[model samples]
Target: MSELLQLIKQAAMEQVESSKPVAVMIGKVVSAAPLEIQLDQKLRLTEEFLVLTKAVVDYSINMTVDHTTESHTHSHSYQDDSTSRTTQPHTHNHAYVGTKSFTIHNKLKVDDHVILLRVQGGQEYIVLDVVGGGIL
Candidate 1:
């Protein structure tokens, strides 16, 4: 009886260990909207990486700004003791960086990753219905 009980416990442990991991991403459906997509708005996505043995998403973001200014002066004198001067104006420029994310149409959970699958008419993306789990 003790051996049978031990075997049952081991089977239960194995079943628990075999369970796959799941990730969920939540967002509204923006593709079917009347208005156009905004500048800083995220795109659409699918349902692939959410369910996996282990989900790993590698991403990075970086931003930088640069500026420069130059000036010069011109002077003229000696026409009946009169003098005239001129100066150049400075130069300035600005740069901007924007990052975009992804969304889905189907059931998007809270902790899932938003991944783009396919573009369906215009810029909208169809969701990926993943039945199985993830590997890498």
Candidate 2:
């Protein structure tokens, strides 16, 4: 019985080793071609067949006053006014600044650089980080 078990284990190991070369070949085939071509060929489809009809939407970074801070942090709010005719009201708030209002005690100064990240939904642009205090 022990000898039979050993033989079975050896056969399993050999099978795994023999498939390594085939796996490597498949990897080479996949990496040799561009992703778009490979997907089209593999799925037997064309780009136009899978084309999306949704309208392309674009976002732009905008700056506004920080009116919700009282100490060291600043805050700003953004609203999308593009689809005002639609039923959905698109608006969001972001507290990028740490204080409730911008004050002289904080690191932020008037005309300082504020980074706004264009995000999808909820808070569109959040304060990533603050820079440029020496200008003031």
Candidate 3:
């Protein structure tokens, strides 16, 4: 029946409108502390609704330096009954142990453009990375 087909179509449309799987959007950071991002003129997301990635957050790492070789050249004078002098080059192998810290990323700032992934159900957005001319 025509009415039955129309009903099915209307129900399908309603279901599509109500279900949100995922969405990608571009947003501009409006505030840093207690971050705020503006998706549009009418929609702005705050920290509570956002999840940040390592690329947009201040991240640090520690590294270790191990065994290494060092070379040095020096002259040694040896005086024998014959009075002779000699110079030699020496190579030294040393075990080096040290910790190095590295900063992988910097936090986002106001006016920065970023890419965001809208999580399913549309309740939260994950900040993937900073884009354009920004700290990224």
Candidate 4:
């Protein structure tokens, strides 16, 4: 009975270890107007990173049968900038070390959302995404 219990515990431990999510770092906000962010280390996204910029709101609005009141709403659109570059696949080595820059051509305001993903390699990290955010 003790041996059987030990086997079960080992299996459970293995399952939990395999289900852990990878570590992700929130990069710094670079060029708020252009919406650029610098990561502390390079990031390799499986797919193209999706960034959404939104405006910050203070309150909201509500209407009643007797009277109406105004509030605040937070919302923004994804604007395309002429300088925006499409997602590309590339590899780099230690030689490419240094602060790398990625520009979000679209005009970004405060409180915008930036989503990044690894669209290509299964578990391998891409060279471009593996840079330090401070370098930018």
Top model by lDDT, which number? 3
Query: For residues 35-124, what per-residue lDDT tens digits would candidate 3 score against the true structure?
Result: 999999999999999999888899889988776657656567888789897767555566667997878767989999999999876889
- Each model's lDDT comes to 0.37, 0.33, 0.86, 0.40
- Report the lDDT tens digits of candidate 1 across residue range 30-133: 33222121122464333331221212222343444344334434443434436554445444444433543433234433333333332322223333432233
The sequence of per-residue lDDT tens digits that candidate 2 reaches over residues 42-119 is 432222222211111123334555544334433445455853333344355455543333223332233333333323
lDDT score, candidate 4, position 124: 29
Q: Give candidate 4 misplaced runs (Cα > 4 Å).
A: 1-22, 41-48, 53-136
On residues 56-111, what C-alpha lDDT tens digit does candidate 4 reach at each position? 21233333333233443444444367454444443433333334444333433333
Clashes counted in candidate 3 amount to: 0
How close is every model to the real structure, measured as TM-score?
0.18, 0.18, 0.62, 0.23
- Return whichever of 1 and 4 wins on lDDT: 4
Instruction: Kindly report which residue stretches of model 1 are placed more than 4 angstroms away from their true locations once superposed.
Output: 1-106, 120-122, 130-136
- Kindly state the number of residue pairs that clash in model 4: 25
Which has the higher TM-score value, candidate number 3 or candidate number 4? 3
